[model samples]
Target: MTRPRIRWHIPVFLAPAVVIYTAVMIFPLVNTLRLALFSKIDQERVFVGLDNFRTLFFDPIWSEQFWNALGNNFWFFLIHMLVQNPIGIVLAAILSHPRLRFSALYRSAIFVPTILSFVIVGFAWKLILSPIWGIAPSMLDAVGLKSLFAPWLGKEEYALTTLALISVWQFVGIPMMLIYAALLSIPDEVIEAGEVDGITGMAAFWKIKLPLILPSIGIISILTFVGNFNAFDLIYASQGALAGPDYSTDILGTFMYRTFFGFQLQLGDPHMGSAIASAMFAIILVGVCLYLYGVQSRMRRYQL
Candidate 1:
């Protein structure tokens, strides 16, 4: 009997998607990286090698802002890792409890903010925290802690942290859902075995469930890292491109935006902007690599 011929139509089915992805994503990415190596000369594009990158890292005027923005971006990621993930895990644990009532309702309510546009969330929080509006101060007073109510968003020392926390509040649902799914995937028999082995309640979560959920936690951590580094919308909406006061909340994303598009007194510089984008891509690549090789590999070992 003749062997059936293998189908050759698979590539045809995937061709459109591949073509579109290349055009929209891959081509733009490659072009941007190429642009990073070129500079403009009297309205003409000219190759400049790594001069833009060198200036970004070595020139005093640019280096200061570059390092400052990079540091702020790391701190922003750290905050999400510390605050958001823990809160999400705890909320997930509580929501996953068998005894918990209205689980769906609670989940929906908590997740509502994540579905809102960054503009809406930013502006809404701005108004809610406005000193003139008296909402924040009044709410604090109702709780008998009025002195704790400061214009946190307006203070340079507090603006970044405040905005970071707001972003945390908005995005916490993602991790919570991810973790909740991980928890739900745990077999009842395995959980019962843990109970038989004297692991119950919090101990079960810590010793049994937590170990099984390490992979999901690692994924959440990496997602948080990427999201925090690439964050722009909330900061831009709330603090504007200047990232005031006096650029205290300026992160790489906003810095890249202002550099690329120009803001106020500054003229746009596409080469410098592309260099910044390339730097951001490098940072994110490094982070993902570390997570995959370091955190994820260790987690897999533990799972095995």
Candidate 2:
């Protein structure tokens, strides 16, 4: 008797998703890169090769802005790493305590801001910070510290950092939830074993829990890297596309948007815009690859 032929159904199941992904993501990406090769001349697109990238990197005017924005973007990522993740981990630890009361309510309240629109968050912060209608100055005045209050979003020195901190406030809940879930996944018996070995409370967390959560922290780090680099909505909503105060807060996303769609006198330059986008894609890819090969491999070894 002839054996029945085996058939693979997994590809059949995945074909539609693959098609959708190619159509929505991969095709657009390839098209953008292709567009980067052409420049506009008298409103006619002309092949320019690497000219756009040359201008982006080597030209003093463009290079200065590019490097400055890149540096600021790195700083933004660093702030989230230093402040947001640590705070979230701490909150998660506190919330995970077996004896903690109203943990659900606390978690819900803390996470509420993450669901709000960037526009809403930005405008709400703007109003609260407005020197005239806002309560911030008055509240500071009540504490005799009104001198410290200023239009932070309007200041060149403070605008980017201020927006970074505001973003941290809104998204800290994500890390908190991830870490909380990771912490909960640890076997209770292992924790009890730690307790028996004279490890309890902070000692238990630092010695036992923290080690187990390193992988989760790595994931959080990479996620923060990608998110901070791609961040545009909060900055745009609060500071506008120009990232005002003379472009003090212009990250890659806003810069690319302004480059792609002309703002004011500067006509849209699609070629340069695509180059910027390609640069961003390259940066993100490098970051992800580093995390995957370096940090993730080490994490796996530690896990084993």
State TM-scores per candidate: 0.95, 0.94
Write down the TM-score for model 2. 0.94
- Weakest ten-residue segment in model 1 by summed lDDT: 295-304
Tell me the lDDT of candidate 1.
0.93
Residue range 48-159, candidate 2, lDDT tens digits: 8999889999999988888877888998999899999999999999999988999999999999999999999999998888877869889999999999998988899988
Off by over 4 Å in 1: 1-8, 301-304
Clashes of each: 0, 0
User: lDDT of all predictions, in order shown?
Assistant: 0.93, 0.91
lDDT by residue (tens digit), candidate 1, 14-39: 99999999999999999999999999
Error of 2 at 174 (Å): 0.3
